[model samples]
Structures are given as structure tokens and as C-alpha cells.
Target: MSYAGALWLAVQEDLYTGICNGTRENGDINRPKIIREESKGCLECFDDYFLSQCFHLSRPCLTFLLDFIKTRLKKNVFNPVSDSTSTESIILATLFFYAHGFLPSKITAKLGLNHTFAGEAVNTTSKILSELSSSFITFPASYNDRMGVAQGFKNISGIPNVVGVLGCFHVKVTPPPSELSLFLNTLGYPSVTVQMVSDVDGNLLSVEQCYPGGTREQYVWERSTICQEFVSFRHGQTWVIGGRGLPPGRHVLTPVERSQLKTSAARRFNITHSRVMTYNQHVFGCLKARFQCLNDLGTVQADALESVACIIKACCVLHNISKKFSVPLPREPVLEPVHPTQDVKGKEGEKSFYYMEETREDMIETCFGQIRDEEEKEANTEGWL
Candidate 1:
């Protein structure tokens, strides 16, 4: 309420009370009214320190995102100055909404927006940002780029030919419409299963939103364009590494197929591959760490899975941009293994199981077998000496 309206309401309350008390007749009930001063609230709004802790970005970083929006909007729906909701404010509202996981009402109160305007700003900003997700989060384009990421994975435990790491995380939602059983996950919560691929640097390369948190990561992969392109391109000797949630395939490799590996060579390869895959853990560690909206982790905050998923996609872009600026990672505590950012198993997983068995053995022989041979030669040389 405005200052004047609140004053009038208080005065009316006093008069009504006087009449009810019978302290004054109708003539005396109406008199000049006194209004107590309104207390000051929200002393600080969107401060730099607060933005860093809240929105996970400094003022400069926020401004950069805003500027990107400005340029993109110049040719479209945005009227930076004339629009009732300034582009800058919309971006701030979106960040504030997700950063703190606050509702539109609280956003209105804290951000000082008019009632109901916060939600609009959030929706508008989210749409704008999501549309540009591809502009912000990009996958490897050239062969060199693929090799670079592969080399990064190779650095971890000397694992090679790893173009990327695959993973999934659930974005919680209000109990989805009861009709949609697919939206409910194993945890008995409504969510959207988000599948993502990150380079060894923990930068998100590709992200696809899938429904029903219970949907397996491998199923999502089989249906994803990234997987299709990967399989079709067959970039020589390059493949992404994933958890057992996905079948060992030509497009994606899992640790040296434990069930089939009967030799020491395969065992050595599996040991190293397992260690390198933990880098996926760190990537997710960094992701949910940077974007709190995705994790129910510290606090039980949620929204519509679709909206949350879109917000997450937008944040993913910012996550990439923030990396370029060297924004400090969040100080979130070490996450337990139960963190939602992990894997999924598909019903069709069985069909794809032996899909790449030959490819797997060949890769083992061509990639990891050499390592075993070198080790054996060195051990024999040492014994001879």
C-alpha cells in the first residue's frame, strides 16, 4: 500500500473502533486523525556483496549479462528505457528470483517492484535468456575442440579419447498435475530430469531437458540430438565417457565393461577410467554449487519443473559466461553421493548394452592395451637389470 492509503486506512480503523466502544457519538466519531510514521524497510537492495552471495555474480558480471540482453533485444521486443520494466531490472529480477529462490511476492517486496510485476519480469527475462542459451552455452565445433576436451580428460588418470562426460540432475517442481505420472520421480517428487554434457573443465557443453525425473540418462541420451550427432559423426577415436547408467556404445563409453573384462589389461583400464569419471562428480559439484536453484540441497525450494528447467537452462548459459569472467565458485559444502546431479538407468539400456561391445574391446586394445604393454615391458626391464 502507498503511504497515503495506509494513513487513510488507519484513520478509518480508529473511527470505527471509537464508534464500537461508544466512546463518542456519530458527530464526534469523525475527527482529524493521527497516523504513526511508517518504519523504513529494505535498507539494502541488490548490493554487490549481496549479489555475489545471492545471485552468484558481482555487479560487473550482472551488467555484462544485462548488456548482452540489451544488444540482443535492440532488434526485438526490448525498449530499454521506455519499457515499464527496464531490461536491467528484468535481468536483476530474474537473477534475484532464482538466486534466492524467492517467490514473486517476496521479489516484489524486496526488489521494490509493483505487485504482480515481479512475476512478469521473471518470465520475460527467463524467456529472453533461454532463447539465447545456445548463444551462451556451446559445444565443441571443430575436431580440434573435441581433441582439446579429450586431452583434458586424458590428463585425469591418463584416460584418453574422452570428448565429454555425461550426467543428469533433477529439478524439483510443485507436485505436478496428478494426471502426469511421468513427472513424478523415484523420490516421489515432481521433477524434470536434466541431462547435460560438460567438458573436462566443468563448463556445460550441451543441455537437454527431459521429463519425469525417473527417466534414465541413457534413454534421454538415445533421444538427444547430441547423441545422434555424436554417433553419426564418428569423429575418429573420440567418445564421451558416462556412468553405467548408459550402455557402453560407440558414441559413449562406460568404464571398461567390468563383466566382460577378464584380463589384467582391461582391469587396469577400468581402474583408471573409474578414477577419471569422478571428474564428472566435480563438474556437477561445481554446477549445483554455482546454481543453487537446481539443488533442493541446502533448502527445500522448488517451482514448476518446466519453469525451473528453463531457469536452469538460462543459468547454464550464465554459468558458462561467469566462467569466462572467473567468477568465484560458490562456497557450498562438500556434496554427498546422494546429490541429484548423477545418473539414470533406462529400460532400453539392455538393448544398447552389447551395442558397442566390439567397439569397446577395440578401444581397450588400441587405447588402454598399449599402457599395459608398456608397464609389462618396464617391469621385465627392471627385473633383468
Candidate 2:
């Protein structure tokens, strides 16, 4: 049998037995007559018809998955739950959630566990997810490496030397009490400016983060580090604004001057430039646009786009893309069969038991038959050969 087919059978077997035997109300094995009959039939059916459905994995792969779970659980990063909840149950429920995006009740039926236990498990697992999100999700270091590098600009327009061009935009966030409110609050305001040294590519380099309420002088000074990094990397790159170039000189503009210049430029270009007033504005805009483009992409594509954005932002600040930074991305790992036989027993003569029942073959055939009928109806509607 194919590896995947074998793996599926093994997983079903493991789950059925693991739940029935692992949870005992009293010392005696709670083998109801119905459960025993079902299990016997299931075993026979498995041996005769689905023997090929078993899977194996390398030791390293198994270790990796276990270690990942252990690390998260040990840190108490999981969602907060009642003290009575079992960590093992939480972890299993979490795995199901991640794989299928279902709620606890749905997973309870699939795993053959009590609904209340499943709910508690999901809560605990959510804590772990929350912790992972906070600790692991980060912008790529490539962003720093590629900061201060511009792309797509080839010509100049009307202003005396441009000391810096800022990208401004507002990031709309739902008000307080929302899940994303914290990040919005961190920005201190909705609008922000992103100042980068412009390049031949018409892209801004050396991105920096800042509040929206700061004065023009404060904004420029706040971004001075990024500017300095950019300049250091590209020794001779000039800063252009409008049509003029600002020779290498420390120039700080007042709020009035910056506002007036921005207004005049917007008029001339017929493009709205008010959004480029703060660092938060710029970063949020860039991120939103990039994420939207990647929403439908596969995991690899999404990851690549995220990396590219980070690198581009970094190059804009550093004026080079060679620096290294680590970016964490979501990864899906292969799951292995969970054997209940390995679990510890509380007392002598205590043994874990599982119930597996043979589902009627006719039931399976009927389901497939229904699916075929549906497909034929759709095909007829579409007039497909």
C-alpha cells in the first residue's frame, strides 16, 4: 500500500484504542459488551481488508514533533484553561484544530472524547498558539539587509535638492477591545510616515518605525539612524526630493516647511502624498498590500513574499541587501501514529483498551455513490464531456 494510505489506517487505529482505554472511571476496564463486539469486528476487518494502512517515520521526525509540543507546553504558552484539564488532551485537540480549523465539539466526535474535555483541551491549546504567535512571529532579517535600497526610479521632477522622500499612509485598525488593538495602540496613532532615501528604482530605502504625532524635526531625527545606515552602505548615493538633490548635508525642516512642500508636490504630481507622514503609516501600508497579494498563494509563495518584503524594507534602510536576519514562518509537520500502549498505567493489572468498530462496507459504498451522483449532476449542468 501507499505510504499515506498505510499512515491513515494506523492513525485511525491509534485514535480509537487510545481514547477507549486511556480514560477509566474506575479500576476495572470499562469494556461494555457493545464496545467489545465492535472492537473485535474492527480488528478482523483491519486485518483482512485494510492491512496496508500503516505508516512509519524516522526517529528524527518523531523527536522533532514531540520536542515542539514539549517546548510549547513547558512554557505554559497555551491558552489559559481550568486547572483540572489534562495537557495531553489539550495537545491532541490543538493538533486537530491546526490541521482542520474545527471547533472543540466537532473534534470531540472525531476523537471520540467527551465534549467538555475537548473544550478544555482547545482552550489550553489556544494559549500555546497565542504564545507561539507572540514569541515566534517576526519580520525577516532580510528586511534589514535590504533596507535603504530603492528600485524603479529613473528621472527627476521639480524641487531643489531632495534631502529625503517620505512614504505616508494610514493603517486602519478597529478601536480598542479588538484583538488587533494592541498593535494599533503600539503605533500610538493611525497615521505614520516612512522616510527612505530614494533610489533609481523609485523605491525608498532604510525603513524606520515611528509615531504619527511627532514633529517634522522629530520624525527626521528619529529616522536618522536608518538614514545613516543607508548612507554608510552606499557611500555616494544622493537624496532627491522633487527635482533637486540635497548634497550630503545635515538639513532638518520645520513642520510648516515640510507640510508646504508636501502639499505643493501632491498638487504637481496629482497624487495624494498626505499618507507618507509617519513611519507606522508606511510600514502598515506596505504590509497590507503585500499580504493581500499573497492571500491566495501557497505556503511557499506566501513565505517567499514575506521574506522579500522584509529584505526590501531592510535594504531601504541599510542601502544593502547582504545583511542577515532571521524570519520565522509557519510550518506544517507530518504527524505520526500515537500509540496508547506506551502510556503509563496507574496500578498493577491496569491495561489501556481501545474500541474500534468495523463500519459497514455498504455505508462507505453508498457515500461514494452519492458523491458520484452529485458530480454527474454538476457535469451535466456544465455540459462537460
Best by TM-score: 1
Least accurate 10 contiguous residues by lDDT in model 2: 350-359
Report how far residue 233 has shifted in candidate 2, in Å: 19
Name the lDDT of candidate 1. 0.64
Quote the positional error of residue 134 for candidate 1 in Å: 1.3
Error of 2 at 339 (Å): 50
Candidate 1: residue pairs that collide: none
Evaluate all candidate structures by whole-model CA lDDT and list the values in order.
0.64, 0.32
For model 1, how does the per-residue alpha-carbon lDDT over 1-385 read when each residue is reduced to its tens digit?
1113245445434543543343444464234222232332121222344456546776677777776775655546553334423545566667755655554453444344665776766766776787887887777888898888888887875666777777776666554355346656656666666788888777888888745666666678888878877766746657777777776666677765456878876887788766756766676666666665666512122333455666778777887888888888757534414333335444443455465678777667777778878999999999999
Task: Estimate, for each residue in 147-206, the C-alpha lDDT of model 2 and write its tens digit.
Answer: 323221112322222234433322232222333222232235422223343333323433
| Regions of model 1 farther than 4 Å from truth | 1-48, 72-85, 103-107, 177-181, 184-190, 234-237, 297-305, 333-355, 377-385
| Alpha-carbon TM-score of each model against the true structure | 0.74, 0.26
- Model 2, residue 194: what's the lDDT? 32
